[model samples]
Target chain A: MSLLGGGIFKGMAVTLRNFVGSYFYKDRLTTNDYSWRPSDKLPQHAGEYPKEEGEQLRDTTTVTNYSRNFPMLLHDGSEPMDTIRCVACQICERECPPQCIYIEKSTEKKENAGGKPQFYPAKFDIDVSVCMSCQICVEVCPFDAIVMNSQFELSTPDRFGGLLLRRDDLLKSNDYYHNIHPEEAAARDKRIAEEKAAKEAKKKAAAEAARKKAEEKAKADAEASEGTPDIQEDAE
Target chain B: MSLELIRDILVATVPLLLIFPTLFAFTTWLERKALARIQNRIGPNKVGVPLTRYGGRFSLFGLGQPMADGIKMLFKENIVPRDADRLFHLLAPILALIPAMLVLCFLPIDFPWINNIQDSVKAFMLDGAVIFFFAITGLNTLAVFMAGWASRNKYSLLGGMRAIAQMVSYEIPLVLSAVIVVMMVGSLNAAEIANAQAGWNWFIFTPWGLAAFIIFFIAALAETNRSPFDLPEAESEIIAGYFTEYSGFKFALFFLGEYIAMFAISGLAVTLFLGGGAGPGVAALPWLSVIWFLVKIFALIAVMIWLRGTLPRLRVDQLMGFAWKFLLPLSILNIFIAGSALHLLAGGRLAGLDEKQPILRQLMEGANPLVVAGLWIGALLILYVAANGLNQLSRAKVRPREYKYAE
Candidate 1:
């Protein structure tokens, strides 16, 4: 019923189309020439990549929104320590599958971004060599403090010192996060805002309920005092 | 041995020796570029002219990559196993190169200098060049086996055995398919076959030749170890097969020999099917035949590269079955069809027409156009149905693949 060797022609056709299409269609050729300098898409928020060959981040990337590698701590202001979101609860450290995260809670509390006294990590280190890039730490963090970073050019000569990323290296601005992962960062921010609004509403309701209870208690006391006076009158 | 005889030989042969190796180098670059393009990736575009690496300046589209590769291969350490057969290991690559080089002489390229050379002195212009080509080409198998045996490694031995099994199996169909051309031309000489197809009278225009060409091309792919049939050197299975133990210039020689073999086979294909050196502008400029021949050879090589990029290497059993059960039967049927077509369409020509005249010309000149057309159509139909029937018969009964470990 079928033509013999027809499949070969069909396969050859597909390859021929691919061979021809690649020259005309830009998207077909996805590889970026890494040897070339800064693609315009880069330096959006991270600044110019290091000029040195060894320290240079990949100047061009086809990294999409969901592409993630390693975990980084998020902050909002001029100083990372002052505006950091992590309260050093060690929740991520406990939940990490690979046990790559290391955190030491500060002896004293400090004022965080929310104006709440929170314990910051005195020592936060992520052994990138050990980290599996599973994003479990991202999932476990309750404070929205840690998120996956797509910056994969983390190679270093000194395996111990270089791969064990410190607090300073892990800390990245929220703006940089939004720049790299716009949709996800925006959604996270909106979720946090909604939770804050709900908390404020809950606090207001609790205060109103407390005020109503106090008013009822005071009225009951006044009525009892009035009933006692009436009893005295009756006695006289 | 005399000076004039030596001169005449050099005139005929030296260009072949020089031109093909250079083409081999360029073909390496071409294959990489083509395969990369097929995969939608840039290949070898970084290594351009030397001293251009500073500040990431100047890339000449990676043309220098082949030269760089050649230099690296030359300088690399020639490591041999202590237990290896040192003599054969050293000789295997040399042995591989010799036959591939020898077969190049058999191609009917019509090189320009041949006009001045004496007919007796021209070794390539042989009475049985076609047969000689097949005979010499089979020697590559021996070289492959030698390389494998000499290496004293299990993987190399496996590769060598696979190569022998594959090449021997495929060569049957390869030669069988060509027998149709030889039959039609009434000559085993490469030059005669090429001459028979002059002025767009390619034998492939006939239904039988079409079938034989396809069969020949497939067998050629297996014979040369081109992919989809490259089980002998299946890197995943045998770690580069027979060449696993070879390194440095010895390895380079093997690589060179393989590419030259590819070129030689492609040239033969052009001679047999595509009307060897028969192209436009050849009538006016005789030298253009050589160029056209090389161009056609490159076209086939390009297809080989494209197929290599597209198809996965075949399993050994599947490879053998396809060659033996599928291709062998099909090629045999093709020969039968060609004999019948010749009898039906050009019966008188086969018996009494001048043998020197092209078969296509004789058939056309002697017969009515409508009768010829009807016979050609009928022949094509019969060949197609027979091929389809063969395809159905040879297909494996298994519907889907079952992995033993995964399940």
Candidate 2:
């Protein structure tokens, strides 16, 4: 009832609890073991990090997917032509608030299967000094060409030379994207697959119509040879 | 010097030289590790490792961190300010360190099994060690002032002033609390005081002794310039305090003095309250005294570290007010109460009781243990309530803060 020295005792109890709890209650301690051999908690790497909240803080470090630092270009990973997702539409280049993005559209004529001259980034640059990592560029990119990278360790001695990242430095494979953000990568993969399937279906329909027309024409010619009437009346 | 005298000198100095550095090193390690644990992190597990080939699996832990720190300090440049008083600046740390080391002389850490060499078991003992300890430790104020003033910096000067103020103010409560123990024990010798508290006869068990221990402990925190009372070296406010200009081994010496003082004061507290080197096995195997002494010292240090981790630094004004108005009064009253209670418990005469009997035993024999304990506990509770009431009455009549909420 007197409350005399009670606060001091309460504080001491709290600290003592934490000190003991750190050993047993894995979540109380935020220290990574940093061992050489792989552990059950972290099998892949010596220092296993937590990717989500309320997980064990002991023997672990946390990595947040949404810690947007620098921008990176995503290149699709399948076969002969590893496609650059960026159509070089220059939408991100236009929408970037800091004007850090400098994109030069490819001048060379390179046609795809559809006979459309596909544009690629000939010289893409992002001056990280000016870039605020607002993620507006990634958001505005219609083709999902750009995504924010979580690699924050971009320190360099040569400030001006090191910070101005080029297309080569910005490029990351789709596999890497999946490793960092699996859900986002899965959705993007499904969307791309659907688009490809729809294109294939349209092509097949057009080919079928053309083949049928040729067969009809051949039949009409045969009829003419046999002194039978006209093919113009077949429209109805 | 005679050969016998020289041997005697070596016996005293040789062991101490080895022991003090080792104590300082381990204390630092203990502090870092304990603080880290309290703050929910791993600390200093990498420095002592011999090989990194196997990384964490096979490598040694960071136990050699203090050695690394010492080596680093040795190589660093000793910087002296351009306009500083160079003589005092150099001498201050040495001055500060001497008293800390001197206090260890009075402490009887081990009670030996061999009867012939019993006197030599301790480093040395003085007739009035408690008085000597207070006198020597008081000189630390002068050393701090010298360091601060010699640095020729405003922040250093300010820190030095605060150090003196806090030390002087807290000395009253520190001395008063110990005085109560002295009153009960009726001796000035450190060894005698410790002997008074035999197995389980520790002062901490009794109500008045517990009150005195708490007061002494708080005062000790201030005396050693530990956190919650570390205003003199508050890094956030003033950079490095009085030793701002010091570098290299000079700064390390200042640091060494601080830790040694912490051990010294805690050792004194152990002697006063926790029954120094007195344990169950100590009677049969007297060598256990060393182990018991170390265990108690480290336990006290751990508590200090826990406090450091838990409590925020007290503001300068709050620190001063708490010492002067709160701790000072409480300690003085505790002394009075301890004296009167002892008298009452002894049937109104302190002389007729059996001297060998512990106060707890005496009280239990005089009355029932339960009744005596209950009465003492009740008295403490009443004191607490009265103290709280007094504090309220002292505050200026601004309607209590709770009234504002009502309005």
Number of clashing residue pairs in every model?
Answer: 0, 2
Q: Which candidate number maximizes DockQ?
A: 2
lDDT per residue as tens, model 1, A38-75 = 55544332333334465565422223677688889999
DockQ score of each predicted structure, in the order shown: 0.48, 0.57
Question: Residue pairs in steric clash, candidate 2?
Answer: B45-B62, B48-B62
TM-score, candidate 2, first chain: 0.66
Interface RMSD of each: 1.1, 1.1
Query: Compared to the true structure, candidate 2 yields what TM-score?
Result: 0.81
- lDDT tens string, model 2, B1-407? 56755666666656666787799998898888888889888778867543454343332456777777888999999999999999999999999898998888777776342233335434446768999999999999999999999999998999999999999999999999999888777777888788888888888887788988988999999999998899998888998789788899999999999998998899999999999899979989889987898889889998889889998888888788888888888888888888777766767546666665445355545665665776588758856765676556544362424534554
With a 3 Å backbone cut-off (N, CA, C), the pairs that clash in candidate 1 are none
Model 1 lDDT per residue over B129-187, tens place: 98999999999999999999999999999999999999999999999999999988888
* Candidate 2 local lDDT, residue A93: 88
Listed per model, the TM-scores of chain A against the true chain A are 0.78, 0.66
Q: Which residue segments of model 2 deviate by more than 4 Å?
A: A37-69, A76-82, A85-87, A112-115, A128-130, A149-164, A193-236, B50-61, B111-123, B345-386, B393-407
